[model samples]
Target: MDVLISGASVAGPVLAYWLRRRGFFPVVVERTPRPRLGLGGHAVDLFEPAMEVASRMGLVSALREARTESELLVLERPGRPAAELRLNAVVPAFDDDKHVEILRGELATILHGVTRDDVEYRFGDSIRTLAEDATGVDVTFESGETRRFDLVVGADGLHSRVRELVFGPESEFRHDLGGYFAVFSLPNYRRLVGKIVLHLGVNRMAAVYPVRQTKDARAVLMFRSDTTSQHDHRDVAAQRELVRKTYAGQEWELPRLLAAMDDADDFYLDTISQIRMPSWSRGRVVLVGDAGYSPGPAVGGGTTLAMVAAYVLAHALEEADGDHANAFAVYESRIRDYMRLCRDAAPRVLRNGVPRNRVHRAIAETSLRLLPRLPDRVRSRILAGGISGALSSFALPE
Candidate 1:
């Protein structure tokens, strides 16, 4: 089978790898001109299922070596002492070795590294239109190249052009989560090595974390908004302006971060939203990762979900024995409930991960301060009880 997968981020490469393993010729189309390995990207977590997928791919050791070992998570408050949590204590109850956190770009590099030699990667191009018949999908690229494929998978992230082409408009699937987030790179002037420092205000939050083995740091700015702000995703200046206006006159290390943002060439800003589609497949086209059913960005275990989706989809196709309809049905049935669970986890994560008000912030800080002092058994119980989603395990098809 000749399969064309769009978007070469985490999900696209992963799907390509698995499809190649299943003896299918997979071609990946990335809009970017080249691999975004050196770009400024936020840290992402890989849960148990994703780790299992990596282990199967024989990339876990390399991923472990590339893990972001932030020694501390510091909570900075105005006119208050910073509360700290040892990263070790933050490990969930289930096997701590199963969860791995790495920068998005680093993970993408690792995934792309293992698959580049095997898959056909077309950089600086994207599918302009997809026309499907009973036999295959006829794809026309923005470069004016046309090709036919047995199947087309939209592994693109949120705001996927593939989904917009195959499905209807984006408004039909987009479910705004009432917030916005921005990530940029900055110099580590505070000398915060192996640490993540977060500052919280009434309706806004800002965090800076050190990149492994680098003097540069990554900054994330998030805020609660009354309604979703509309802007072109490619418009960096407009997005930066929105962030600046939202966080004007903010104290507690924000001014320095803002100044650093001006120097960053890879500033990324987006709305914290979820994509929920009733069906992920239509005829010869299907969607995966954030393009189909993103729970939420950053905090929603999106990386893990994407890996799991890739694994399941590949196996489904193999098991269905060339029946695309059966494979798509099985794929959707197996992942739908889990996708909903991930989607519902967003608000809870935002609240606990980035506390809203002073009271919640105090409670969060107190928990972090007390976590390290607790006994191993007690800590395990607390983690299992408190963060069930983080520790949630998924069984994959053999």
Candidate 2:
């Protein structure tokens, strides 16, 4: 079968890899002009199941070597002494042999490296329109080229063009969680080595961690808003202004972090939202990863979910012997409950991570401070019930 997968970041490549391994030809279309190798983004966690998938693909060692190696976390509050904690203790799952946290770009580069030689990648292009018939999908590219494929997979992210073209407008399915997340790279002036520094405030948080294998660091700023912004996601200047206005006069390295944005080349800003859909497939077209069912960005384990979903999708297709109807049905059935759990848990995760008031912030801090001192069994239970557990809850098909 000839399959055209949109978006080459995470799900597309993984789906392409597994599909090719199962005797199918997969072509990937990416909007970026070139591959995003080493173009640093946010740090993403890979839970047990994702790690197992990596192990199966012989990428565990490489992923481990590329991990951010953040050993310590420093929590800073204005007019209060900074509290220090071991990063692994803060999230015990990070200490587990099954979990690895790496830069998003690095993970993408690694995944692409394994699939490039075997897959056809068309960079600097995207689907302009998708016309699906009983036999195949006719895809028109923005560059004006047209092609037909037996199947078209929309692995494109939250604002997926493919999904918009087929499923309707994004706003129809996107449920805004009332927050924004922005990240960019800057010089490692703080000289933070193997450490992550978080500046917490009511309704807002800023964090910086060093990028492995470079003298650079990544700055992440998040804030809650009453309503979702109407700004275009691609408007960099407008996004920067929004961030600046939201974070203006903040304390503890925020001024410097905002200043550093002037020189930051890879700025990304998006609403923290979830994609909820009744169906992920229509005829010869289907959606995967963030394109179909993103719980929420940053707060949710989106990276891990994307990986596992892609793996399941390719496995389902192979098991069904190229019967996309059966395969898409199986794929949705296998992951729907897991997706629901993630989606339902996301609001609480966001509320905890970005406290709305002083009381909430204090409660969150106290919980973190007490988490490590708990008994081993108690800590394990807590980890199993929290975001870590929800992310790793899925059982991959044999």
Candidate 3:
């Protein structure tokens, strides 16, 4: 079978890898001109299930070496003393022993590296239109080239062109969680090695952590918003402007961060939203990962979900013997509950992670101060009441 998978960041490459192993030819189309590899991009966590998928592919050791080894987390408040905690204690609340947090770009590069030699990767292009018939999907690319494939999988992220082309408009299925997330790279002026600096404010939060592999740091800024006004994902200038306006007059290294934002070329800003769909497949075309059912970015376990979903999808296809309809059905049935759990947990995760008022902020800080001192089992039990439970809710198929 000749399969065309859209979006090469994480899920596309993963799906391509598994499909190729199952004796299928997979072609990946990425909008970026080149593969996003190396140490760039934000830190993302892979839970036990996703880690199992990587281990099966023989990339866990490389992933472990490339982890964003931030051993300590320091919370900086405007007028209060900073509190410190170990990263390992906090991580177990959400993941098991099989967990690794790596940069999104590094993970993509590793996934691509495993599949590139066997898969056909077409960069700097995307699907312009997809016309599916009984036999195959006729795809026209933005580059004006046309091709036919036995199957088309939209492993694309939120705001997927594939979903828009086949399912409907994004707004029809998107649920805005009333927040925005922005991230960019800057020089490691703070010299923050093996540590993360965080500033939690009412209705807003800012964090910076060093990338161990490089002499650079990643600044993550998130804020709650009242309006659901649409922002163009491609408008970098406008996004930067929004961030500056939102963080104006903020203290504790924010001014420096904002100044760095002006010169940072890899700025990314997007609404923190979830995609809820009744179904993920239509005839020869199917959607996977964030393209089909993103819980939300950052707050939700999106990276873990994407990896596990892609792995399950390939297994489903293989089991069905290339009967796409049956495979899609099995894939959806297996992961639907898991997807919903993540989606439902996103709002609570966001609310707890990003303080909405002074009291919330105090509670968050107190938790940080108290978490490290508590016994391991007690701490895990307490923290597992939120996103942790939802993250480990899914069981991957054998």
Candidate achieving the largest lDDT: 2
Per-candidate local distance difference test: 0.84, 0.90, 0.89
TM-scores for candidates 1 onward, in order: 0.95, 0.98, 0.97
Q: Candidate 2's error at 25, in angstroms?
A: 0.5
Give the per-residue Cα lDDT of candidate 1 at 308: 91
For 236-285, candidate 1 gives per-residue lDDT tens digits of 88888888887889889888888888889879988888998889999989
**Best of the two (1, 2) by TM-score:** 2
By lDDT, highest first, what's the ranking? 2, 3, 1
Q: Summing lDDT over every window of 10 consecutive residues in candidate 1, give the lowest-scoring window.
A: 384-393
In Å, residue 174's CA in model 2 sits off its true spot by 0.4
